[model samples]
Target: MTDPALSELTPEQAQMAARVRRMMLIAGLTTGLGIAAVFVAIGYRLFRSEGSAPAADVTATLPRGARIVSTGIAGDRLLVTLEVGGATEIRAFDARSLKPAGRLRFAAEP
Candidate 1:
């Protein structure tokens, strides 16, 4: 038996073929758009800068006889508890820049 030509197809078959082609075209377009969106998102993530790069090494100077008691991180700040002489102190530094944010000192009442 010979294969039927496009012109020889029944009306219903031609309509079904046309509908299939349209569906395929829509599916291809949606797939292409999804791939393009993924690529764009990846590119944006790679190229966008959130903030300045952190320093490689940071050095913090302390007063004479000052010793570190403990260290911790709170949100974007670095907290360091220190014992200086006979008093206790807490210092906060920016986690990214390593710059001093604030300081709190505790001393006994006279």
Candidate 2:
């Protein structure tokens, strides 16, 4: 006995099914490509280096009688404000390598 519901599809129905399958395949490929791109971006960020080795240990020496008033980070530099001999000094160092970048001193006029 042949079941009507399980019978072969009409020509129009078969064409419609094929068109739907094609659309679904395109959508699936697009979604898969997007997910692959995301994974690639994440992998690049995780594995790539920033062209400089990170410092394992850093030691910055301060002058005698120099007291650290404040410390902060500005852009890519680390800033340290110090009070030395009644004068204020601002020192900037490279945040990555801990190298001295520049210095600023504030003094009263004579």
**Number of the top-ranking candidate, with TM-score as the measure:** 2
Give model 2's TM-score versus the native structure.
Answer: 0.63
Compose the digit string of candidate 2's lDDT tens values, residues 22-109: 9999999999999999999999987895776755588889999999999999999999999999999999998888899999999999
Off by over 4 Å in 1: 1-6, 50-55, 62-92, 101-110
lDDT of 1 by residue, 28-69 (tens): 999999999999999998889576775659889999999999
The Cα local distance difference test for each model comes to: 0.93, 0.94
lDDT, candidate 2, equals 0.94
Superposition TM-score, candidate 1 onto the true structure? 0.56
Candidate 2 Cα RMSD after full superposition onto the native fold (Å):
4.0
Q: Model 2 residue 48 lDDT?
A: 91
Q: At residue 5, give the lDDT of candidate 2.
A: 83
Which ten residues in a row are the worst by lDDT in model 2?
A: 49-58
